[model samples]
Target: MKGFFSLPGERLFHVATLSALGFLLLFFVGIISSLATYTDWRQFFSILFSKEILFAIRLTLFTSTMATIISMVFAVPAAYAISKTNFRGKNIVDTILDLPIVISPIALGAALFVFFNTSLGRALEGNLMRFVFEVPGIVLAQFTIISALAVRLLKATFDSINPRYERVGRTLGYTKIKVFFKVTLPLARNGLIAASILTWARAVGEFGATVTVAGAMKMKTETLPIAIFLNLAQAEVERAIAVVFVLVAIAVIALVILRRFTSRRQTS
Candidate 1:
């Protein structure tokens, strides 16, 4: 313990911090473990593998993956620009971009719901495609909610990279675009991976905005979080518990993957 925590503090500091950490961990774990009381061990697998649950899992994965892809497409360029450039109104632009993250998901969803009723939104939907209470709306909601978070994460990554590396690339007669692809991107790979995993995980767990925009229509717009809501609403406690475990499993898998990537990046 002495070797592990070598700061300018007494041994009591270690005990105090570790105690706080343990308390928090146990508090959360205890809450989750209590769900076992509602869970039927015999029916757990059957409930988890049921069509409704499977559909929710598939929909959750699909929406989260699509949203993540779209977000990274926008966030990478946006993060790069914000991190590497200085311009008039840059601070304002950054603040505006970050609004989606700071705003409540429920409010975001409500905003979306209101947008579709506007004349322009109505025309867009009428001429383009329907979005009100639809599958695409779920993707849109998740995208709006998490894209800003991705930008912030990737921006920090880009910020940490030495500008000297990019300058060196330029001195080698490389174009700006080519240098970005060859140098900056490779340097930011870990950050990009981390942002994608975190955003996707967040999308998987999004319920407030998703439900508000997409509505929990069981087999249709029912992602895992939505499925849990639906099950609990219908008084299906055991099924809800089963869905909880499934969500926990997904979150665990994502965290494990993120941890592995971080470890590999650190070692490399």
Candidate 2:
């Protein structure tokens, strides 16, 4: 028994087992509590499949996907730069990239609303300040919240890669962009995918910022979280619960995928 405890592998196995068991206990408790409150499963299922619910689900997926795609487009390169090169104010840039994570998202949304309701948003719109109370506002809010998350994750991914690989690519006459695509990007694919998944999950669940900026219009700006919030506020408990469950399921799936990719990347 002493020898078994002394083995590093055995100790790690013990720790993992303990952690998994703890998580399972909490998960099942929450499940039971939720299930006990729902007396009509069939009615709940019917509500879940209602047209309004379906529309919210579709819109949530669409907006989250769009926000994630936009985040990835910029995050990868910014992360690469921050990881690979030394430049003026690089520290400041990195700090700024992480600032959103600390800010209250709802407050951020309100500030954005003010900015856009005034000149900044109009300047950006050029003729579409209508975005403040529209779909674009929701997307923009989601994008702002999720983009910071993407940049943080992608930066970590890039940092995990050794710069020696890029040096080797350069030695072979590969351009920076070529090296990035052929080597760095491939190596960081798992992190990028994980980041994108997490970003989408975060964007989908975003409510405070979204509500403040998007002005929850039924079937117009109502994403899943917003739907759940509006339903609960109006005393539609069952519908709200169903939506919450769906959101929880989505969040669980995203985190599971993120973990799998992150684990595979680490092991490889």
Question: What's the TM-score of each model vs. the native?
Answer: 0.94, 0.87
lDDT of 1 at 67: 96
lDDT of each: 0.92, 0.87
Clash number for every model? 0, 0
lDDT of 1 at 130: 85
Error of 1 at 239 (Å): 0.7
Residues 1-268, model 2: lDDT tens digits: 6666668978899989999999999998788467548637879889989999999999999988888898889888888888888999999998998888889999889988888867666888786556677888888899989888888898899998888998899899999889999989998889889888988889999988899988888889999999988888898988988898898789888988889998998789
Local accuracy of candidate 1 as per-residue lDDT tens digits, 70-140: 99999999999999999999999999988998999999999999999999999988999888789999999
Q: Which residue pairs does candidate 1 place in steric collision? A: none
Please give the TM-score that candidate 1 achieves against the real structure. 0.94
The numbered model that scores best in TM-score is: 1
